[model samples]
Target: LFSQVPLVEIDGIELTQTRAILSYLAAKYNLHGKDLKETFRIDMYADGTLDLMLMVALAVFKTPEEKEKSLALMVKKDKTQNFPIFEKILKEHGEDFLVGNKFSWADIQLLEAILMVEELDASVLSDFPLLKEFKTRINNIPTIKKFLHPGSHRKPPPDSHHVEYRF
Candidate 1:
């Protein structure tokens, strides 16, 4: 299985940016959102998830000690600020998924975000009931469950390849 997964190519047009690719597929599959307002809301949450991912990505390639310290700070900001925003969104929406209650791209992104943070700290999500439930709910979806089964595709580690990386 290819690492750096989720690379989508359609009609010879290749997309590499994760959010853009996911959003494109979501739009194609009618999972983006039901309306314009909801689309913007989905974008906000999806971007939040992207920010979480970036925090981890930026830390990669650093010295181990530096990575550890930087990740710790990122976790602090996440737990204190970023996470509460989504938690409140879920609390306010009172729905199974984020945004307009439908299973949108943002829900998928949130599950990715949860998995990314859990990489930093296994118990990081313990305090966030909504996020924890959201992760479990997304995982239980039949198609998603199969996709997530062990030995499936995985995102490539940033430093695993020599690509002249930089922040």
Candidate 2:
């Protein structure tokens, strides 16, 4: 979908951040919320979450001791805080999609977030039924489902073990 409408051709706009690209695509494709303020709020939250997840990934790549400390903190934050927030959002939205009951970029961002976190710590998902359900639900979407299948381009089972924490 994005490739068909490359960012370069969209008024010659350039976006340095993934979140910016997402926002631009959302607005361009009418996937954003009804109002600008709501769209801004959703984008801000999505970007913040992505930033935190990036930090967690960085920590996972650190030295052994640092990785242990980082992962411990991540486990705490993910379980006690982040996961619950996602659960609430999904429940509040009452739809598989994230914002305004549509298949918006926020949903894609969140699906990637869950997949990345699971890769880092497979056990991290065990306790979050909502998150697990959400992942399963998102993976069932037609476009996403095709990519999640065994022979698909975006399959997760293959590369997941490469970064398996030995701790």
Candidate 3:
């Protein structure tokens, strides 16, 4: 059933768990990295991206005032905690990609998270030079460039329909 998701059957198998689906695709596309060590690093970055996404997700359910507060917190955590971690990794690795010096799942995850935050606050990346460069680099990639264009399938930022102020 895929939990009401549109029919998605890969290799005749139905994957319900989020990580399982991502893992399968990453493995199939050779985005899991070269070896276990690389995979570990990629997974760490992927998890970090998920954490960033969760912060934004939490803000979607709050009232306007609460949403503002939550988003401020999200930006603060991102600027002070999340972005610095990735900045350090990119600076130290000195590579085009986050791990193994090659494009992988980690790079994709980070780029997606970066864009999502940028949508909320355009200046979210102002102080993160490497990440800013990283975004430009990733955005220039042929496939990603096309995918990011208007009229593409990329989901837009959360809107009124997606927000709910629960008691």
Top TM-score prediction, candidate number: 3
The C-alpha RMSD in Å for every predicted model, in order, reads 4.0, 6.6, 2.8
Clashes of each: 0, 0, 0
* Greater-lDDT candidate between 1 and 2: 1
Model 1 C-alpha lDDT per residue in residues 1-167, reported as the tens digit of each score: 23564578886787776777877788887887778999998888888778867878867667779978888987787788878888888899789998777898888878877777777779887778998888899999998898878887865546625336322
Q: Residues 50-140, candidate 2, lDDT per residue (tens digit)?
A: 8757666566357778876876776677777887888887777677666766666667677777876777688877877777887888888
lDDT of each: 0.79, 0.69, 0.84
Local accuracy of candidate 3 as per-residue lDDT tens digits, 1-167: 54543234788877666677788889998998788999998998899888878778667666889988878877788889999999999999788889988898888889999888887789999898999999999889999999989999997766677544222
Candidates ranked by lDDT? 3, 1, 2
Q: What would the TM-score be for candidate 1 when compared with the true structure?
A: 0.84
Candidate 2 at residue 125, lDDT?
76
Better of 1 and 2 by TM-score: 1
Candidate 2: give the clashing pairs.
none
Better model by lDDT: candidate 2 vs candidate 3: 3
Candidate 3: stretches off by over 4 Å: 1-13, 163-167
Candidate 2 regions off by >4 Å?
1-15, 150-167
After TM-score superposition, what is the CA distance of residue 29 in candidate 1 from its true location, in Å? Answer: 1.9
- Once fitted onto the true fold, the runs of candidate 1 whose alpha carbons sit more than 4 angstroms away are 1-7, 160-167
